[model samples]
Target: MLTALSIRDVVLIEALDLDFNDGLGVLTGETGAGKSILLDALGLALGSRADSGLVRHGTDRARVTASFAPLKAGHAALDLLDEAGIEVEPGEPLVIRREVKRDGGSRGFIADQPASAALLRDVGATLVEIHGQHDERGLLNPRGHRALLDAFGQIDLSSVAQSHGEWRAAETALAEARERLLNDVSEREWLDHSIAEIAALAPEAGEEEALAAARSDMQKGARLVDEMDGVDKLLAGSDGALAQLRAATRRLDRLAAEHPLFAEALAAFDRALIEAGEGEDSLSKAAEALRFDPAELDRIETRLFDLRALARKHRVEADGLAALLEDLTARRAAIDAGEQSLADLESRVARSQSAYRNAAEALHAARVKAAAALDKAVASELAPLKLDAAQFRTAVEPLDQSQWGPHGADRVEFLIATNPGAPFAGLMKIASGGELSRFLLALKVSLAEVGGAGTIIFDEIDRGVGGAVASAIGERLSRLSDSRQLLVVTHSPQVAARGTQHYMIAKTSDGTVARTGVRSLDAGERQEEIARMLSGADITDEARAQAARLMEVV
Candidate 1:
């Protein structure tokens, strides 16, 4: 509900402040008493388009601020404010301010936090629905029809939307899988041949390194064997030094028994013989190690060539062939099982589709039932608002497959026929300005508890209607105010008398500057204002009596 409005230098409103209350409040005054100016100021605060002309003469800028306090939680405007990063504490009023400069520049704020006019407009839509003869907000938009209908019927659509999303996800997965299968068909033969070739090779880890070392040894075998044979001949052959050393040692041992110098010579010869035997044993071991068959050397060289060739052909190192073989084998297996996997995916898609179809059908059925109830409910309101001849309808039509959405596979529209025997058409197309306002009111009354802004303002809803018709309009507005705050700008004395709170808009001049002001009417003041509306410029005793009677009825 709008809590307060402050205007500064906006047209004739030099400085004005007005506080609002819950329930129905009506603003009444003589023609050109700045009632429209008050609305313009409110509109500017609600983020309507700005114009430098709106600024008062000689003023640099014009500013308007509006405060709203939603009595209940979970109002849609709160969500919008949250999304915009505007803070509104519990029990705190949300303040929106707009300033238009004489230079045609403008600024806006929500909760004193700087905001864009576009965002302010979005948030304002949830706070107020300004219905008039030329209304474009609220029910005038067809986009919100489905959601409004669902709210009216108390239908919860989260499950249906969730199921639809899941179905789409399943269908997307199946399509991608099928596309992969079709694209890979030409590669099936190539994959099979590669798998077979790699399997036949049976490459082992570290085989390449072992084979290379053995080949290096085989290549050096002939040179190593020749060197060992030369050492063996020098150390133990028939002309070798070992035999000469044995003869010398025997002579030295005999002389040593007679002379001490001989003993030294015999010991030296013994050491020489031990050294020669050690050298011969070392050479024999080397000769055995160097030995290699020609066929074995040939086999090592051929295996090395085979490993290198295969490595090059596969664009990998010889050591990596084993890993490559495993990958090819896995890919081959996948192709072999592709058909069964695709079949399983198809079954899953079918199940998801069935679930989605069931949910959509159920939603469609509920909408049809809800639409009929809504039509009847709105029809009941039409006759009281002086539209007994008008026919109200809720048209539900099936949507094409491509148009089927998360909500449902149906489109809902509000239709009307203002005269008997007239074909029903869109509300905007068939009803005149006055008829449209009444029709909107009837529809609003029917769905008063469904989806509506916290504050609703009707501009001259009683236009061109009088007597009982005016009272009926007032009664409906009052009923609507029971759930939400309502404001009506009217000249009808009966409607003005119905306001829980009455405000009189009047313009005054201080010889140099003219300004607009609004004041809340007290009990006695309200009677005088109503009487003025009843009898025009002259408020007679009879008009006052009638005003008292109207207040008594209220």
Candidate 2:
């Protein structure tokens, strides 16, 4: 509920403060007495569009602040604040402040923290619902009709939302499966060929490294084998190094008896011949060990080239080719099994669709039932508001399958027929300005127990009616306020008389400057104001007496 409103330098309203209370509150005044100014100031504070022209003449800026009492924990306004990333302390009052400068720049604040204008607007919408001929939300827009009906019936759509999500998810999975099958079927031949080529090569993880090592050793051994031929040539014949060493030993032995030096030389020559013979034997064994088939090196080279080429073709290292082969083989297997996989996905999609259809059917039936009940209730309110010839309807029309969604497969709208046998049409199109106001009132009265904002403001709701009709409208407003706060800006004395609280808006001029002011009216003051409304520019004794009677009747 709105608790207080403060305005500064807004048009003719400079430094005006007013406190508000629950139940019916009325703002009554003569035309051009600045009653509209109060509503405009309230709209500004509620995050309506800002205009520099609204700033008071000779003022640089204008500001409006609206303070509301703490709301229920899960109220729509609180949820809106939460979604905007704004936090209010528990038990804290919600204070929304908006300031517009003369240059058209504006700022909004919630609880003293700077906030975006959009956030302020969104939160404000949930707190107060202003219903007038020009109002575009709530009962005016057909797009929001479903939500209003659901709120009215206390209908929970979470199950439908969950089922819709599951259905969409299943459809997505089916689409992906179909796409995969299409793509894999197209690649089936390439997959089989690649797998076959890889399998034929049969490359092992360490085969490339082992083959390289073997090739290196063989190439070195080939060089050694060529050099060993020279070794064999030097050590094989009688004139070779070992044979010459044997001849030297014989000559040294023949001269050994001639001197001791010759005997030592003979022993040295004998040991040299023995050592040369042992070296030749070792060289022969080494040459035999180096003997290997030349084709073995060629074969290793061929295998390594094949492995490296295939790895390059597949964009992998030689060692990774084996793993790539496994992956391709698995893909080929899946392609061969694509038909069954698609069937399985199709089955799941069908099941999900069935579930959604069942849930939507139940929701559709419930909406139809709720719409009938609402029509009946609104019908009960129309006669009292001087709309006895009119008919109210809550149209529950079925939508096509493509339009089915979380809210179900129906379009809900409030329609009306202004007279007997007249065709029912949308509220905005068929009803006149005055008729629209009454229709909204009757609709609101019917839905009063179920939904709407904490505070509802009606501007000129009693515009085209008087006498008994005005009294009936006032009675409904009074009854409507029993559940929530209601404020009516009116010229109807009967409606004004129904208010538990009353404020009179008046205009005054100080020679050169004119200003608007608002003050709470006491019982006697209310009587004078209502009398003025009754008599128009003059308060007669009979008018005052009638005002007293009007007040007592409500």
Candidate 3:
């Protein structure tokens, strides 16, 4: 609730401080008495558009401060402040201040900390609701209708929101899976052919190098085999070097037994034979090792060519072919598994859809029931406000699946019919200005415990109505005030008389400068004011009597 407001050099308000209280507070005065100026000052504090014209004639700047007592714990406004990194201590007042300079620029503060006008406006919305000829929020916007109905019905939307989230998640996963499947379909045939070719070749690690080495050895051995055969014939053929050495060693051994001098010559001859025999044995083994088969050489060359061709086709090194083959095989296996994976994702999407449908159906049912009750309650308040023939409705229309949202699949709107045989239309379209205020009043009274701000200010709700209609408006205001604070600017005597607190706004001049001043009226002062309202500019004895009677009833 707004606890106090201070205006400094704003328009004709030079300097003023007004304290406020809970319940219905009324501001009453004659025309051109600056009641609108007070509202303007309040709007400025609430971050409305700033203008240099709002500054007083001689002042360089104008300021307005609106103070509110601490809101209830967990208020949405406090959460907004927290999100902005602003600190507000518990049990402390929430002071919103705005100042406009003559240069057409303005500044705002919340709780004495610098703030943006946007933030001030957001915070102000949580503290007070202003219903007038041009209010865009509250019961006016159809966007807020669903939440209002939900609050009135005490419906919980957590399950609905949760289900919607799950459904969207499942939907997204399915979309990605389908895209992957489409891409894979284009590559499926290529994958099958490549896997088959790799399997047939059956490339192995180091096989390419091993085959190349054997081919080189066979080519070199073809040249060396002829030289090896020549050396073997030289060492082992008849009458060759080894045969002559063996005959010389036998002659020397027979001579050594007959003559001592031949002993030395026999030993040298035996050594020569031994050396020649070793040379012949080495040549024989070399001739055998140099032998090569033409068929085997052809096979090695063919194997090498096959391996190199496959490596080029796959755009990899000969040694890397085995790894590439393994990778492609894994890809084919994954494609085979994709079918099962797709089935699981489809099942998940179905489950999520069912969950969301169940929750939305339940929410829609509750809203339907609540809409009927709200209509009934609002209809009951219409007759007393002179809208006896008018019908108030809380219309819940079904929405298509594409329009469904986290809230539900229903579009809620407030509708009204001004007279019999009149088709129900939007609240804003069908009602006149005076009728709209009364309708809003009736709606507020019915939804007293539903969606509303802590404080509500109605601008001239009894603008053209008087007599019993004025009395009815006053009574309903009083009733609405039972739950929350209400401030009304009125010219009606009946409405003025119902205020628990009364203020009088008047324009005064000190010869040079004119200013607007507001004062809290005492009991006698209220009587005089009410009397003035009843009898115009003159207050008569009968008017006082009537005022007294009006005050006595409430």
Off by over 4 Å in 1: 70-74, 87-91, 205-262, 279-324
What TM-score, over all chains together, does every model reach? 0.87, 0.91, 0.77
Write candidate 2's Cα lDDT for 297-351 as tens digits: 8898999999999999999999998999999888888887888988998898898
The lowest-lDDT stretch of 10 consecutive residues in candidate 1 is 231-240
- lDDT for residue 109 in candidate 1, whole number 0-100: 94
Give the winner by lDDT: 1 or 2: 2
Instruction: Please give the TM-score that candidate 2 achieves against the real structure.
Output: 0.91
Quote the positional error of residue 71 for candidate 3 in Å: 2.3
Question: Per-residue CA lDDT of candidate 1, range 1-554, in tens?
Answer: 89999999999988888999999999999888888888878888887899899999999999999998844578777788888888878887889999999999999998899989898889889888898777677887777888889989887787679888988898888888888777666678887777677667777889899999998987788888887767667756567668777887988888898988889888988988888788777777777788889898888888778878888988999889899988877766777788998999999988987888899888888988999999999999888889999999898888887887789788988989999999998866855787888898899998999867888999888888889888899889988899989999998998998899999999998898888889999999999999999999999999999999999998
- Cα deviation at 463, candidate 1, in Å, is 1.8
Kindly report which residue pairs in candidate 2 clash with one another: none
Q: Root-mean-square deviation of each candidate, in angstroms? A: 3.5, 2.8, 6.4
Candidate achieving higher TM-score, 1 or 2: 2
Off by over 4 Å in 2: 223-290
At residue 438, what lDDT does model 2 achieve? Answer: 88
